[model samples]
Target: MNSELEALNSLIMTEADGLLYEKGLIRKLEKYGDVFISGSYFLQLMTWRDLDIYLASDKMNEETFFELGKEVSLCIKPAKMNYRNEFIGHTEHLPKGYYWGCYADFNTNAWKVDVWAISSKEFEQKQQEIEKLKFQINVVQRMAILKLKNSVYNHPLYRKKFFSVDIYNAVIEDNVNSEEKFKYWLQIKRGLSLN
Candidate 1:
């Protein structure tokens, strides 16, 4: 990998370990079921502008979930709170009581800290899919995926694509590198562009 990309990844990991975990959010969320840093940040891919932390729960209510978000914000002291409405339209499948919130301004660079409260079953299913993809893709292909993520998939100009999962699936389905797959993926995305 390149030095710049490595530095970005290092910056993110340091924040996750130092700020979130050390501040007791990771431990606090353990009551839910399992806690993880997932999405693009978990994959250690560049172009990830935020830290995505997921709390998988066997049971939780919408109110309780939102309450947890508020507590998290209080603990993290975010500059802004990103509510559920911001993420609702982007999720492909949302489980019962699923909540999305974010903490910003914790990092000096303005990187966001997004928290997702989800169901355990859904989390496991998604992990399986990622595992399957890992089994099929080679190291270079994975790097290609990261390059695509940083260059095109997560680019500010391409607000139509919210996250990297769709792009990852596209890479697998097309069995092609990031650049080639991006061209094909762009042709079929008919969803309303958030830009």
Candidate 2:
């Protein structure tokens, strides 16, 4: 088996404090760093040897660190600014990326008040939705939207690292048009909200 899968299997069998992070999990987290980081500003961890040399750390496992070459280091928050959303030599920024967003507050005055992260793709899709609302005709109200630019988004199917029931309801009851209640934030910003 691949090293990542083997590590996960071992974790499952050994009653380790954490589960192993797979490549798919890595991809998904990188895809949605904004959502995950917002929930885990301090979730990153590393290991040290008896000589105090820094060994590999599990970004996903809050507890232990697998040594280098044993398993891939768990990318704690893949989409963090320092990694993908980073600057090149302190000058140009990486191309603008998106994070997953949900309606935290429906009012423009409170639009940016709520804080969170989202995947870059979901971030763009939500952008399209808000841009849709920005040009809408009367009868539909556009609430001020705050973009979640860094973490992995979660509800149920999402890794569920940053699940928020309240955000789920806001997206469903607001202006979004998505049939799936899972994409709650997108629905609100899109003006297709069920509410």
- Identify the candidate with maximal TM-score: 1
User: What digit string (tens of lDDT, one per residue) describes model 1 on residues 102-162?
Assistant: 6455556565776666668767776776667667666666666767766764456464444
Off by over 4 Å in 2: 1-112, 139-195
The clash number for model 2 is 30
lDDT tens per residue, model 2, 88-107: 22323112321122112121
lDDT of 2 at 12: 31
Q: Report the lDDT of model 1 for residue 68.
A: 78
The ten-residue window of minimal lDDT in model 1 covers 186-195
Give residue 119's lDDT in candidate 1 (0 to 100): 67
- Hey, what RMSD does candidate 2 come out at? 18.7
